[model samples]
Target chain A: MRIVASALVLSIPILTAAEAARGETLTVTLSHHQVRITSTYTGAELAVFGVIGRDGATAPRSGDYDLVVTARGPRANTVLREKRPFGPVWLNDAQVKFYDLPVTMAVLSSRPLDEIADVDLRRRYAVGLDTTRASNIAPPGAAVREEEFREALIRLKTQSNLYVQDERGVSFIAENVFRATVPLPATAPPGAYEVEAALFRGGVRLAVTQTSFEVTKTGLEQFLAREARERGLLYGAAASALALVFGWLATVVFRRD
Target chain B: MEFYLPIAEMPVHVGLVLAMSAAVGFISGMFGIGGGFLMTPLLIFIGIPPAVAVASVAPQIAAASTTGVLAHWRRRALDLRLGLVLLAGGVVGTLLGVLFFNAMRRVGRLEPIITLSYAALLGTIGGFMLVESVRAVLRARNGAVVDPRRRPRPRWFGLPFRMRFPQSKVHMSVIPPLAVAAAVGFVGAVLGIGGGFLVVPALIYLFRIPTAVVVGTSLFQILFTAIAATLFHAATNHSVDLILAMLLMFGGVFGAQFGAQAGKSLKGDSFRLLLALILLATAARFVLDMVVEPREPFSIMLSEVLP
Candidate 1:
C-alpha cells in the first residue's frame, strides 16, 4: 500500500510538469531603434501555417515575424503599454529576416496611425455640412475654383510619397504605413474626428485601423478668406477690366485689316 | 490665403482654381458652343457637388452666351422672326422644365437621369453626324448630289401660325419651332446648358431651316433660357458660384470668339463631324461611369430642398 501511495505521489509531479509546460511565453526588447519580440506562446500571433489566422492554431516558425503594428494610448517602460496583436503586414518573411529566434513576440511602436494628408477644395463649394454638398460643395457667392484642387493634389502627389483622391471634397487623404505623422493645416475644422485607416502588408491588406482626433475650426478659415479675398478680389477685378480694354484694342487694331 | 474644403485638412490655393477655370475656358474657346457640357461633367468628375456645378455654370454661360450673340450679330447672322418665335417657346419650356428638374430632385433621381440623358444625347448626335458625313463624302466621290431633290412634303405649311423666314425663303408653322425651343429649354434646365446644340440641329433637320437661321434662332432662344436658368438656380438653390463663374467667364468670352473664328474656317461637314466626335466621346464617358461600379460605398440620391 505504501509503495502504491509513493508511486501515485511521484506520478503527480510528472503529470503536473507535463501539463504546465504549455510553452506560453512572451519576451520583448529593443534593438537598433526597432522593437524585437521573443516568444513561445503565440496566443497573439496573426497567422498560422502560411494562412491568415489567429495565433491559437500553432506556434509560428522560429524567426523574425515582421508584422504591421500600431500603438496608441500611452507609453510603457522602454516599451509601449497595451501591447496587443496588430497586423495586416507591411513586411513579411521575404523582407524581415529571422533575427535569431525561438522568439515569437513582435516588438512594435506605440505610435498611432497618422493621416498623411487631407485636402479642402476651399470653402467655396461647401455649406455647413449640407448633404447636397456631398455631390457638389459650392457655397453661395463663393468664387468657383476651376481646377485648383486637382492641380494641387497632382502637385502634392509628386512631392510627397502619397496618393491623393477625393470623395466630392468630403474627404481627401492618402493611405500609408503604420507609423506615420500626417500634415494638417492651420484652418482644420476642429471636432472629434475619425480618420480612415487601412493597413497593407507586402501589398496585401492586413488590417484596417482607425484613429480619432479633435479637429476644430482654428479660426484660420476666416483669416484665409480675408486673405484670399484681399488677394483675389483685386486680381479678378483687374483682369476683367484689362480684358475689356484688350477687346477694344483688338477691335481697333484689326479694323484696318 | 488658405482654403478648406470640408473633407480635406488643408486649404487649397486660389491659383490652382484659376488654372482649372482656364481649362474650362479653353474648351469653350475650342468649341463655339458653351462649354457647359464640358464644365458640368468636368466639375463632377473633379469632385465639385452637382448642385454647385449646375449653379456655377450659369454665370459663366451668361457671359459667354452674350459674347457669342454679339459676335454673331456683327456677322449679320441674327434672324429676327425666327429667333423671336423660338424665344417665345423657350421661355415657357424653361419654366416647365424647372418644375421637372425639381421633381426629379424630389424623387432623388436627378444625377442618374441627367447622366444617362447626356450620354444618350451625345451618342446619338455623334453617330448621326458620322454617318451623314460619311454619306456626304461618298456622294461627292461618286460625283452625285447626295440628296436627290424630291420636294420634301410641306409638313409644317398647313399648321397654325405660318411664319415667313426671309433668310430661309420658307413659310412654316411657328408650332414646330416653338415646340423645338421648349424641348431644348427643358434640357437646358435639367442639364445646366443653354440647349443651343439641341436647338440648332432640330431646326436644320426637322424644320429644314437654313443653317444660318438655325444658328441665329438657337442663340436667341439660348439667351432667354440661360437668363431663366441663372435666376432659377440663384433664387431656388442659391447655387450661383459668382467668383468661380467670373473667373471662368474671364477666359470664356475670349475663348468663344476664337472658337467662332476657328469654326468659320471649317467646312460645314467638317464642323458637324467634329461636333459629332466630341458628343460621342462625352457620351462614352458617361456610359462608362454608369456601367462601372463606384469605389465608394454610397451612390448619390437627389432630392429637392425647395418646392
Candidate 2:
C-alpha cells in the first residue's frame, strides 16, 4: 500500500494536472539481454520489469490493472508422427508438419487469462497456450485430424517443460510498476527470444510493449558446437584419432600383464 | 556429474555413460570383439538420438579393436596380406553403407530398419552358435573327440584371381575374402558395429582360414572399417559426438583389460555357450520392443523436417 501510494504521488508531475489519462505507454526492460549457455548451464530465470506511463495529469484508473507476459524462442520446422500397428509391429503411419514453430514458449499472467480478457481478444493477441496453438501455421495439404497432432505436440512439449503456462507469474510491486519471471530450461536453443508485456484494465488492453534477448553458447560449448557444424570432416577425423589414442594408451598401461 | 553433448544437443550423466560402456566393454573383451553392437542400442535406450548414437559408436568400435589389432601385430599372429585384401573391400562397402544410412534417415524409417536388422541378424547367429556350442559341450562330456575343424571347402574356392595367403597356409580366390569382408563391412557400418563376430566366423568356416589367424585378421579389418564409417558419418550426417565417444572409449578400454583377465578362467565351450545366450537375449529384447504397443504411440521426430 505504501509503495502504491508513493507511485501515485511520484506520477503527479503538475504540468498537465487537469488533463485526462492519454497516450498511455509501457516502458519495458529485462534483467539480462544475453543469456549464455555454458558447460554447467542447467537452466536460467529471467526477470521482466515494466512501468505503466501516461500523461502527467491523468486521473487514477477505476479498477485494478492486469498484465500478461509472454516469451517465445526462435522458430523452427517441426514434425509430429503417429504410429499404428502394422502386421506385428508398430510403424509410423501419419505425420503433420508445422512450419516455423517456436522452439520454446511460455505465457505468464497476473491472473487467469480468461478473467483478464475475453476469448476473442486473447486469441487475437495470441496471449495463451490455446492462442499460441491456434497461431501455428501448418503447411498446405497437411494431414487431416491436425488438431490431434497439434494437441499432442503441445502436450509433449509441456511434458518436457518446453511450453509453459503460469496463471500468477507476474505481480505489480507498485501501482504502475510490475515484474515477471521467465524460467528457461537447459534445452532452450540458442537464438533470439521475444518477450511481450501487455497491460490491461477492465478486460481492455491499454498498452503493449515488446523486447528481445539472445540465448548464446559460450566457451567450450560454443567452440565444439561450431566445429561440429562447420568443420565436419576434421571434427570426425579428430574424434577417431582421439579414440585411437585412448585405445593405445590403454594397451600401454596394461602391457605389463 | 553431467556433461552436454554438442552434436546431440543434450545432457547425459557421466557416471551412467561410463557404467554402461564398461559393462558392454567387458562382454566384448571376453568375446574378443568390439562391443559396438551392444553399446549402440544401449545408447539409444538412454535417450541419445539414434543418429548420434549410431555415428558416435563408430569411433568407440575403432578404439576397442585397436587393442586386439596391436597385440596381434606384435605377436605376428595375423595375416597382413589377407587383412589388406579384406580392408580393400571393406572401404567400398563402408561408402555404400553411409549412402544407404543417409537415404533411410531422410525417409524417417532408419530406426525401424535398424531394429529389424538387429533382431534378424542376432537371432540367426545366436541360434546357430547355440546349437554348435551345445553339441561341442555334449561331445566333451561323453569323452568324444571334440575337434571339428576338418570340413570340405566350398565349390567357389576355385574362382579366378586366386591368391596364396602364405601366413594362413591356404590358396583361394581373392574374390571370396573380398566378397565376405564387403558384406560384413556393409552391415557393420549401417549398424555401428565392428563386424568382428561376422568376419571371424566367415574367415574360419567359409574361407577355411586357420583359427590361429582368424581373430587377428578380423580385428585388423574391423579397425579400418570402423574408422572409415566414423569418417563418413561425421562428414555426411554431422551427428557424431566426440565428447560422448571419448567418454565411452575411456570406460570401454579400462573395462576390457579387466574382462580379458576374467575370461582366462572360463572353458572354451562354456564361453561360446554364454555368448550365444547373450546374443539370443539381445535379439529377444528387440523383438519384444517391436511387438509390444508403446504407451505413447505418437512420437516427435526432433529434427528439421522442412529445412
Candidate 3:
C-alpha cells in the first residue's frame, strides 16, 4: 500500500502566493497508506520520501534545505488532571478539558525543531511537540492555568510514547530529494493521521503540503473491537460463556475422580 | 511475546500477564478464594487502564469460581435455596455497581474511588482475618475446643422474612443473607472480585451457616454474581478485553491445580494467616501509593466528551 501524494506548493504564512506559484513544490510518497494492526502487530516505521521541485523562475539556493514531517493522529477530547496534597494523600484536584486533542503526534525533522525555526514561528506553524495546540474549554468564571496543563499533557503523552520526536529523522539523499522516518509506537491509537511536510531555508518557510494515512485493526483484532463497540451486550454474553467453558474444561482436564 | 488488546488499546507482554495471573491464581487456589482482589490492581500497576482492569477481571473471577461451584454442586455441599436468595440480591447490587462505576468514570474520580475502596476493604477484612486466625492457631496449640452451639446469636437474627435452609440446617431471616450478599455483590462488581473471602465469614458467623456448606454456597453466589458483573461491564463500559481475560483465565485455571496440591500440606490456621498477610500487603501498597507524592503530579485521560 504505497501512497504517493504530490502537492502543488501552497503559500503558507511567510510564503507569498506568487512565490509559491513559481517556487519549490513538495511531493511526498508514503511507504504505507494504511497500517493494519493484527494481534502480532508491534510498531511500524513509516518511510516518507519527498522531492523538492522548482519551477523555471525559481532561484537555486546556496544553502541546504530543511524538511519537517509531522504526523498527527485523529483529534479527540482529553482531560488533564493535577494532583494536590490533601490530608496526607494526593488526589486529582484540578482538571481542564482540552478539545480536539491529537491522540498521537510525531515530529520528524532534519534538525532540532528549535534550530529549524524560532519559537514564535514554530508555534505559529505547529512544527514541534510544544507548538501543537489543543484549546482548553474552560468553565465560565474559571481562571485556567493553561500553560502548566499543556506542558503536563505533553509530558504525559511523551512518557506514554504517544507523542514522539526525532530530531534527525529526515535526511537529504540528493540535491532535491530527502527522506524521513516516522516512528509509530505500538501504543499509537488507530485512526486517520494527517502527515504534513514543510520545506524551509534559512528559517524562512518555502512550501507546505499535507497527506493522510490510516491505522486500522485487522483480522481478529478488528472483529473483536467492532463487536465490543457495536454489540456490547452480545459481546459481553459471549465473553461470559467463553469464560465458563474455559472453567469447565479446566475442571474436566484436572479431574482426579 | 506481546499481544495487543483491542479494548484496552495497548500491547502487553504476554509472559508478564500470564505469570501475574498464575501467581495470583496460586494464592487464590491455596486459600480457596477468588483472586480478583489481587489481579485488578496488578493490571493497573502494569499500565492497563483502571476501568479496563476492573472490568476485564470480572470474567476471570467467574471462570475461577466455576470449578468450585461445579464440584460443590456435584457433592450436594451447596445450599441451592440460600444461593438463589444471595444471587437475587447480588443481581441488584451488580446493577447498581455498574451504574455507579459509569458515573464515577464520567466525573474522572473512578481511579481514586477504586483505590480508596480497595484500601479500606482489604485493610479491614485482612485485619479481622489476621486476628481470628491467630486466635484459632493459639487455641489449637492449647488443645481447646470452641463450641459453636454455645455462641450467642446476634441481635439482627430477628429480622423479618425468615427462611429455612434445610441443607445447612439453619433457620434465619432471609434479610440478613440478602443484605450481606448485596453488599458483597456491590463490592465485587466494583472491585472485580468474587467476594468469596467476605462471604465465607459472613455466612459462617452472621447467619450461622454450617461450615460444611459455607464455602460451597458462597462459591455458588460468587460464580453467578461474577457472571452478572462481567455481563454488565462488557455491555455498559465496553472495557472488558476478551483476549486479556482469556489469558488470565487460562493462567488462573492452570496454576490453581498446582496451588491446590500445595495447599493440602499447610494447616488451616497457618493458611488463613498467609492469606491475611497477602491481603494486608496489597492494602498497604494502595495506601502507600495514595500517600506518596507521585513523581509526576499530573495525569491525563480521554475525556468523556469525545469528539
Candidate 4:
C-alpha cells in the first residue's frame, strides 16, 4: 500500500510538470521492481501503469490516446538451428547466430500496432513482434536466410511463452492513465529487464520512458546457482557425496526387520 | 505440488517427477539394471531440456546402483578383483566420453547426435535382447539340454595378458574384459546410463562370469562410473541439476526396495520377456521420433556471453 501510494504521489508531480511544460511526455511506474524466484515460483504478473501527459492545445480525441509498452529481458547471444532431412534421417542443416537478442520480450499495446504507427516507425521502436526480428543480424559466412530463421526463433520463443505480443493488453483506465499486465513465464531466466513505454500522436513518437527491474533467485535457487557457477568442482563433489549418503541412508532406514 | 528446479530453470509437478522416477526405479530393481535409459527419455518427454536431463540422471543412477551393490554384497554375489579391473577401464573410458560430449556440444551437433545415437543403440540392443530371450524361453519349454563344456571356445581366448577369475570359473586374457568394460563405460557416459544392462550381458557371455556375481559386479562398476560422469558433466558443462537428481532419487530408493521384494515371485523367463518388451518399446519410441516429422524443426539455445 505504501509503495503504491508513494508511486501515485510521484506520478502526480511528473504529470503536472509535463502539463506546465506544454509538451507530450510519458511517466511510467511499476507495481514492483524486484521479482524474487523461490521454490514455489511458477510465474508472475507485473502491473505497469503510466500517464501520458500532453498539452491541452494538441490533445487528440478521447479515444485516440495510444500507448505501447514493451519489456525486454537481458540481452545475450543465441544460436538457432533448423533440422533438415539428410539421406534417411533429419540432421541440423541451417544455423544462424544472433547477437544481443533479448532472452525474453513482452509487448503490449492499447490497439493494433499497425493502426498506431507506420511500418518504419514500428521497426524503429520495435513495437511489434514482426518488427523486432528486423533488428537481429545474421552471422557472416553463414548462409542464413534471415527471414526464415527469424520467424523460427519467434515461433519457438512464443511457444515457450518467453516472447509475447498482445494487441489489447494495454487499457486506458482514465483519459490519460493506462495500465498493462506483463506475464513472466516460469522458464524466464534471472536478469535485469528494461520496461519501455512510448506515447505516440498522429503516427509520430512524442515521448518515451524506460524503467528497469531485476529478477533474482532466492533461497535454495540462489545458493545452487552461485555454487554451480563459482565453485563448480566443489559443487560437483558435494553433489556426488550427497547422493552417496542419501543412498546409504535409504538402505539403512528401509531395511527389513 | 510444483517445485522450481534451479539449474533446469523450470517448475515441475513434484508428484509427476516422483511417479516417473519410481516407475523407472521399480523396473531397475526388478531387472538389476540402472534405469537411465528409461528415466532420461521420460525426463525429456516431461519438458526438461535433454542436456539437463542427461546430466542430472547420472547422480540418481549412482545412488540406485549403490543400493543395488549393497543388497548384492549381503548375498556375497560380488567378485571384487574382476570389478576393479572393469572400474579401471571404465574411468579411462568416461574421461574420453566426456571430452567427446563437450566437443559435440561446441559444434552445435550435440542434440542431433545424441538423438540419433540413442535410436541406433537402443534399436540394436533391444532387438538382440528380444531375440535371445525368446530363444531361451523356447529352448526351456522344449526341454532341450546343452552341456556348457561342449560349447566352442571363444576366439579371443588366445590373447595375451591371461588372468584367472576364480569366482567366474574363467581363465582368459584380461584384454577382452577390459576392452568390453571400456566400451560399455564410454557408451554409459555418453548416454547418461549406468550401462548395467550392457555390462551384465558382457560379463555373462563375454567374460563368462557366473550369473550370480554379474549383477553385483556390474552395479559396483556402475556406481563409480556414474559418480565420475556426474562430476565431469558438472565441472565441464555445468549441466548437473542437483535438485532434480535428489527428487528422482528420493522416490527411486523406496521404489527399488518394493520392486526387489516383488521381483522374487516372478518367473525367470517371464521376467526376461517383460524386460525385453520394455527395451523394445523405448527403442521404438526413439525410432518413431527420428522417422516422424517434428512439430517444430527449429531450436534456440542461449550462447555464453564472452567476457
Please give the range of 10 consecutive residues that has the lowest summed lDDT in model 4 chain B: B144-153
Q: Where's the lowest-lDDT run of ten residues in candidate 3 chain B?
A: B298-307
Q: Considering TM-score, where higher is better, how would the candidates rank from best to worst?
A: 4, 3, 2, 1
Model 3 accuracy (lDDT, Cα): 0.78
Candidate 1 chain B lDDT trough over 10 residues, lowest sum? B298-307
- Residue B19, candidate 1: Cα error in Å is 6.6
**lDDT tens string, model 1, A44-124?**
111100111223343643221222222121111110011111132111011111111110111121111112111132133
Candidate 3 per-residue C-alpha lDDT over B124-161 given as tens digits, one digit per residue, 9 for 90 to 100: 98898789878988898899865343488776767888
Q: Model 3 shows how many backbone clashes? A: 0
- Please, what is the TM-score per model? 0.54, 0.86, 0.88, 0.90
Off by over 4 Å in 3: A1-21, A139-144, B30-32, B95-122, B145-166, B187-194, B208-212, B258-266, B303-307
Q: What is residue B39's positional error in candidate 4, in angstroms?
A: 1.9
Indicate the fraction of true inter-chain contacts that candidate 4 also forms: 0.65
Better of 1 and 2 by lDDT: 2
Error of 3 at B36 (Å): 2.3
Local accuracy of candidate 2 as per-residue lDDT tens digits, B1-307: 8787776767789999999988876766556667777888899888788999989888887776676666556657589999999988887776787688778778876777787987898889888878988998999899986644555667777999998989888888999888877887777667556677777656755777765466567777777867877888888888888889898988887776556555556666666677778878878987887899989877878656222
Tens-digit lDDT string for candidate 4 (A27-137): 888878898889998978788888877676764565777889999887778889777886666776667877778888999999899989999989887887877653454
Candidate 1 has an interface RMSD (Å) of 19.5
Model 4 clashing residue pairs (backbone)? none
